[model samples]
Target: MSDIFNQVDNSIYSNAMTFLRVPLVMDPIAAEADIAVLGLPFDIATSGRSGARMGPTAIRQASINLAWEGKHFPWKFNLLKKSKVIDAGDLVYSTGDAAEFTQKVEKAATQLLASGKTLVSLGGDHFVTLPLLRAHHQKFGEMALIHFDAHTDTYDNGSAYDHGTMFYHAPNEGLIDPQKSVQIGIRTVFNEANHGFNVIDAPQANDMSVEQISTLIKEKVQGMPVYVTFDIDCLDPAFAPGTGTPVCGGLSTDKILKILRTLTDINIVGMDVVEVAPAYDNSEITALAAATIALELMHLWTVQNKQV
Candidate 1:
């Protein structure tokens, strides 16, 4: 999506609203983008802090720092140059009903995917991934999930709408194949039942090198369509404190980004950076972190689907 996700030459402090000020579109197909960005601004499913509903705006504002820059550092390619990216704006849905909200998100996602554009979501909370999975499943057909978070979010948790239970429900609904998936950066507790996905708990991730973590992720998701979900709380509170459920002893910022950079070879279907609650953040740290993660995701997408 050349010039799609990015706006032309606005100062970082300028009034850019869309994620990186990319042209806002109501219809992705008309834009003919290679990739599209959408905001899932519903946090009704959170079991913790409530303000993730504001995540989309906050992350977009922070992304201004990256928007005006011609190219991202360390990476040898220009994302805007290689791909057409557009901000399709946020999903429009009634805020009153959980079922309706989920349906709207999925419907919006389905429409975007039908355009044959890959999606990168700015989430309202981790629960947003549930509907996202539903949408991607229809296109890619049961992807391998690469989840990064402080909690497994796979708990039964009684209700079908809770953020913690989406993973539990996803595998059952045929959206993802648990055996081919892997969950990383988890520090919270959950039953070790043959949940099918391999676990790289927080301690394990912290102790492991980037090579080890990436190797394990690649091995687990080998030759499969992959969907990556990064919950901002995967970083310690020191790195990302403005999240719904922050956990200590998490991976550092450098550690996670490094791991992501080495993952361009994976067949990624869809991705999101969820659970960033800017209200709890100091000095915009969490939002900026989320923004950077989003950019890195674009890099990953561009490399995988390199355009002429």
Candidate 2:
């Protein structure tokens, strides 16, 4: 019915730009979907990189290939079979104004959540989580964060606009529950003293099996409303070298996917895949990884919220 299927049947190169060639809608409520894909293209807060602003478009381009895959592996059902998903396009905000941008992000996210459709966000940078958290909290109260990153992002205090400082404010501002939250694959330095978050640092994660990590995550969250924010940098530099701040050692893509596959009923409310600066990516792997992750998030949403 669509050019995505008609002209490019099974082709990785599709003429459609919307993620997976799903309809691009400005009016999400009119789209009648169970999930809304929102793009946040503000990257002014990046401390180490600036190109993540282009991430959303690159991710969409990469996802053209996924639209042709009938059934995603490991999951027997097609993600879209049970419900509708609309790409609500990218959030618009004033250019170059970080303060105004955060407000726009929060306002737009709040509006999407108001539609009662789960949101799968495509991020400009890790800092975008701040506004997202604010909006999600207003809906689900304080959520337990399932953060995937190379840095703890709990810089404690300093540089309010920096991506590294979002968690420092998120819990304090009541957007997330630090005690119920967990940061996985962290290799950077951050204060740990009773900071509330349970951290599975890179070394610790590497030593543990994927099942062990997944069990730990499930235990910490314990059915609390969860918000998953995945930084592509959480993958080792060999896997995701296009991110702003690349760390040498981190979770392998296989390890992260294995863990996520086990999180089928963890009460996830919202999710995002951030920091795919395509300029530095090798052979589009970073964008493809982000797209695959995004699709998996959709699978998680669909299968868990199954039709009664």
Candidate 3:
């Protein structure tokens, strides 16, 4: 058989693969033998730029270049030695069908969740989060969300699904309890009609220190399960220029990284890094940033899973 696992850095602990790492795994069951990964490349309906469909590919390619650190964290957990992470590949979908794609995501994610395997999700856009949350809610009811973005993604336009209207549909479906959730690093403009979906606004976020923000989340999200959905637009366009939407005067990259690293004890069941549009990117910096955050998510999984 082919090599089961390979090391990105020889000195780092080895992270295993089941058999082979394909480009994108269309079928979650057939493609995912052990650990599964699925991509949701659905960015056609974005209100901002129209190229976030390339997010999954760009993230995968950038990940290939990252050197895995041997030590999981300073705490001495070794994820590379213990965890068996596989590349299940991206999900398959037809062009120009949002509802169909949502159903497809729900079916595939349900299987993956039932199998008791961790799925590392790469996004097509922010809208994908709603369907993923729907699938997970069916498995683990009423999960808390830790959303990081420039906009509070809770808007129900009384229409179909799209990037801007995802969070609004979540509570209506009973998937998310806005009161139990916390939104960080948000900065943008919105209308008065989009209210009632509880979220910590960015104007308030901007005034507080990072420590204060982290402390607030710790207090608010205490004793509940959380899913982290990071939209690349949460960071300033100067820091991440390659997203479907680029909001100005947002969180800096280093500041966001510090925040993720500080939440050492939050129970992050699953995470998704989204809205990375490569078509607008010149240096490919945004993809690399998203991939790095994915690594941080892996670290969070290792740290939290071991504690359990």
Clashes of 2: 0
Clashes of 1: 7
* Pairs that collide, model 3: 25-89, 25-90, 39-90, 154-168, 155-168
lDDT per residue as tens, model 1, 1-308:
76776645577776768887778887776778988999988788888888998999999999998886668887887788798889988887876588998988898889889978999999898889999999999898988999999888888854768889989999999998888999999998888876677999999999999999999999989999999999999999999999888889999999999999999899998999999898999988999999999999989988888852
- The count of residue-pair clashes in candidate 3 stands at 5
The C-alpha lDDT values of all candidates are 0.89, 0.87, 0.73
Winner by lDDT: 1
Alpha-carbon deviation at 176 in model 3, angstroms: 0.8
Give the per-residue lDDT digits (tens) of candidate 2, residues 44-130: 888886799999998999898788767888778877777688999998877888898898888888987887888999989999999
Candidate 2's C-alpha runs over 4 A off are 1-9
Compared with the true structure, what per-residue lDDT tens digits does model 3 show for residues 3-118? 55542333222321211123334455654343455677888658878888889888776665454545534436555555556666667788888878999888888888787766
